[model samples]
Target: MTDQVATTEAPEDWEPSEVQRERNEWRRRRTLRSAVIAAGSTLLLLGIIGGLVVSSPGWERVQATYFDWDKAVSSFPAVLEGLWLNIRVMALCAVLIVALSLTIAVMRTIRGPVAFPLRLVGTAYVDIFRGLPLLLVIFLLGFGGPALSLQGLPTSALFWGCSALVLSYSAYVAEVFRAGIESVHPSQRLAGRSLGLTYGQTLRHVVLPQAWRRVIPPLMNDLVSLQKDSGLIAVLGVVDAIRAAQIQTAIDFNYTPYVVAGFLFCCLTIPMARLTDRYARKKGYHGAGGHL
Candidate 1:
């Protein structure tokens, strides 16, 4: 039969190995060719898009308003100075939020009738702050605090804004800590107890160390967000970077100062994001089979 003749004429079994090697080599070459073609096409498309945009009538106006070199140069000093306030507030809030959130998480995790009311308070605190819009909290804290006019209570806009930032972030971060703590098996807690460790001692030495390692990535992410929200303090009439930008824009009748401020914020934000990614990779990242 024709089928038998075709099978007999095919390459010998010994030759098939050589054929497979050749086929694999051909596939590699094809993949490389495809990648190069894709890269070239993408570059070409980008060039066309760029050319069209550059030739538009509105491009000149946009460049003058948002990219004026002279305006950017003038705006840098005030914006940089104003950004320092944000840095200070964010730093203080970071420390306070971490300490407070850990306390809240611990309270929530304690299992006893005596601790029930404390646990309920912790749960309510997390839910209220996390559910509310961040801007609303900032508004209430910033405006409402000053209106209270309590003698000896800090009336500074900076103080109230920092308080709001601390309050809201502590709630979110408490959940992160609790999740990390709960991810540790119950046997670990029991083992500590069996070894004559008190609950407090076990949490201090065993549970927290591991939980902190597990949650570092999420904590870093939260910190990054917190750092960025430092700008929101501007709503309280604190002269942060965004506020400085607004003043400059009003004075010059150009939007270039806003761009400069945004650029500075991006400069800081990008570094934090990179550091978070680096640490997450170093720690094996919780989402990717690293324990929560």
Candidate 2:
């Protein structure tokens, strides 16, 4: 009876039935049609908005101020030079922020009375920094830290500004890490402990790997934001892309340099955003928001 049933079953290379083939063709056509319609509607909407803008009275002046080709070409070199600094600062701050935030997250998650003070300090740090505006923190560190003239500390606004970025971003990212850590099932920890693993070993080996994987999408989003906000170091007298643009704008009152800077930022940010979306999709997340 088993042999008979096996012989009756369709083989791996068997063709689909007529109905199944028809259904598959219908699905393919439907997908193609939907894609075409979506593209057409998008283009139509953009064309309408663009026509309105171009027909406006001040269109010429707006174009000259914000989109002057010559000005953009001329300012490109300086802004590109300045952008290198933003990249370096952002890279350094990102590394520091991840290290510090992970430590704080671990501290917050530790149990027992012996760890209470560490947890309390971690909580206070997150609360205070999260509540304070990032720009304000940058201002305080950039100006106020230098004013103190502490012997061992550097007075460069760039130093303090980057420090402020690390501090402020770590608070937000620590919460992200903590959320990921908490999402791990208690059974996993118990299993690790039952295998003769210590608490620290359980967390480091069994827990952190999973938590880090789950939190990557949100972490990337935060880093994308960090990349853009790196431009704010310009406020501290750092000659970053935005500052270079500002200097060019001052020379001739043309805003094209500012537009160039903005375009460069978008170029960096959009790819990161798309990669986050791709990763989220790969992890079975299907929504506008992706979180652990």
Per-candidate TM-scores read 0.83, 0.92
Candidate with the greatest lDDT versus the true structure:
2
Q: Please write out the lDDT profile of model 1 over residues 1-292, one tens digit for every residue.
A: 9999987895665455788999999999999999999999999999999999889999999999999999999999999999888788888999999999999999999998999999999999999999998889999989999999989899999999999999999999999999999999899999999999999999998899999999988898888788789999898889999999999999969999899988888888878878888788777664532322
- How many clashes does each candidate structure show, in the order listed? 0, 0
Clashes of 2: 0
Best by TM-score: 2
Taking the tens digit of each residue's C-alpha lDDT, what string does model 2 give over 167-222? 99999999999999999999999999999999999999999999999999899999
Position 110, candidate 1: lDDT:
98
Instruction: List the candidate 1 regions with Cα displacement exceeding 4 Å.
Output: 1-49, 286-292
